[model samples]
Target: MNKISIGQSELMASQISLGIMRMNALSVEEAKTVIETAISEGIDHFDHADIYGKGASETIFGQAFKKLGISRDSVILQTKTGIVPGIMYDFSKEHIIQSVEESLTRLQTDYVDTLLLHRPDALIEPEEVAEAFDELEKSGKVRTFGVSNHNPLQIELLKKFVNQPLIINQLQLSLTHTPMIDAGLNVNRTEAGSVLHEGQLIDYSRINDMTIQPWSPFQSGNGKKGLFFDHPDYLELNKVVNEMAKEKGVAREAIAIAWLLRHPAKMQPIVGTMNPDRIKAITKTTEISLSREEWYKLYLSGGKMLP
Candidate 1:
């Protein structure tokens, strides 16, 4: 897998991340195989969330890591917090501190390599977040901090008070769900795609030296419809991706991910596949990059247009 330094941090991580959000559905042995497979394929960074399966995903991954017998220092562990299911978003100092403590215990580790705020809290107080981060950093509970699904201004608000570097911003991005890219490419147009939903997030992330981690790389939309692989609505995209895969001599999944890797923004794509074979196949993305024309072809095939 390709490696990149996250933000200004010295922590170099694999460009391809293994997201264990669905690991709670697998048996311990099965989860171990999946994790070991990812490591073998050069994926050292794993993404988790405190709310995934009500924290069962982290518990399962912890058990698998122990059974795999790999040294803790060999892999990078990142997890998210602040989402309390259907209740509310909590960035309070009390919730942040307690959450990390719980995640630490569940993962059987003293500290997480990276900790992220799972979602933005409408009722956030940056000073309270700063206090929580100070405590976590002083105690060595979290090495780095970041956010997810946050707009540019939201990050600016946090940066005002938080002393630590906010290194990552994980967002839902795929060929078919690219409001950020659309807004940038179709500026000043009256089309729906030109409406700036994310406020130049792609540009902001690049200019700020923050890594944008794209989750659900294979999904077409909000994921309510499912994978776009053979979806009838995405015939052109599927056809183009399949052709590219054939030409590249890799799986179709690899082509989809390569589109992300080809971007100059230096994105890290988090894959959620539990199948060992699928994991190995997608790893091919780091080996190849899409040409400028090819990249645009795939983008247009996704039904996005340029004015």
Candidate 2:
């Protein structure tokens, strides 16, 4: 796997990270095998969220880690917090500290390599968040901080008060759901693609040296249903991906991920597949790089039009 430095942090994260959101569906033994398979394929970064499987996912992963007898420092564990399920989003100092404490207990680790606010809280107070971060950092509970599903101004709101660097911003991005890329390509045009829905997020991330972590890389973002593969609306995209897979001698998923890696932003895609075989197949993305012409072809195949 290729390693990219996360923003200005010292953590050199893997280009592709295994998301444990669906790990709750697997038994302890199965989860262990999946993790081992990813590690064997050079995937060292694991992504998690506090609300995933109601926290059972992290618990199962912790059990798997203990069963494997691996050292704590051998891998990077990143988790998100602040979502209270059906209740509300909480960024209060008390909730932030309590959430990480519970996550640490469930993960069988003393500290997380990184902690993120799962989503924005409309009623959030930035100073309260800053205080919570300060306490966590000083106590060695969380090594770094970040946010997920936050727009550029939302990040700036937190950065105004939080002392630690907000290094990563996780967003939903895929070939079909690509307003970030589309807005840039269609600048000054009257087309719908020219309207900025994400507020120059890609450019802001690149300019600020923050890493953009693409979640649900295979899923459509604009209220579309299910994975992009085999979707009726994405027949053209499937055709192009299949053709590239045939030409590259790799799985279709590898071509999909390679398209994200082709961008100069150096995005880290969080793949949530639990199948070990599929994980291994997708790991081959590091071996292939998409050329500019091929990248545009795949983009257009996804139903995007250039001005």
Candidate 3:
């Protein structure tokens, strides 16, 4: 797997990261295999959230990771906070500090490589967040800070007060779910794709040097729509993906991941699959690069119209 410098920071991470959101369902042994497989495949970055499996995922990963006896510095661990599940999104100083303390305990680590504010808090006070970040940085609880699911202005708002550079913005992006890309490509058009839902985040992120961590790299769209592979709405997409996979002699998942990696944005996609076999297959994305035309073909095949 290729490595890229995350934002303007010194944190060099793998091009593809493994999301441990589903690791809670796996036993310690199973989780150990998954983590070991990912590490063997050069995936040194692991993404987690405090809300994932109600924190069970982190606990399992910690136990499994400890059992592996690998050096803590060998792999980068990134996790998110600010989401209280059904309650509300809280970026309060107390909540933010408490979340990290709890996450550190669950992860069985002294500090996280990166910590992201899981979601935008509508009631966010940038001052409180800044204070929390200052403390976290000074105390060595978090190495760096970023946000998830935030638009450019939201990031700007945080940037105004937060002293640290917001180095990353994790968002939902895949072949079929590309509002950020669509809004850019369909500029000035009357189509629904022209709607700027994310305030031109792709451009903003690049200009600001914020790495965009694309999550749900296989989902059809937001919510319970499911994966695009073999989905009824993505028959054409599956055809193109399958044909490309056949030509490249790689799994269809690799093609999907390659499409994201092909972008100049240098996106680090978070593959959420826990299957060791699938993890190995997905890592093949680093072995192949899609041509410009092939990349567009996939975009079109995913049911997008290029203006």
Using all chains and alpha carbons, the TM-scores for the candidates as numbered come to 0.98, 0.99, 0.99
Model 1 misplaced stretches (Cα beyond 4 Å): 222-224
lDDT of 3 at 62: 97
Residue-level lDDT of model 3, residues 66-102, one tens digit each, is 9999999999999999998888999999999999999
lDDT digits (tens) for residues 93-187 of candidate 2 = 99999999999999999999999999999999999999999999999999999999999999999999999999999998888889899999999
Is 2 or 3 the stronger prediction by lDDT? 3
lDDT values of the candidates? Answer: 0.93, 0.94, 0.95
Candidates sorted on lDDT, descending:
3, 2, 1
Clashes of each: 0, 0, 0
Off by over 4 Å in 3: 222-224
Model 3's alpha-carbon lDDT is 0.95
TM-score of predicted structure 1: 0.98
- Tell me model 1's lDDT, rounded to 2 decimals: 0.93
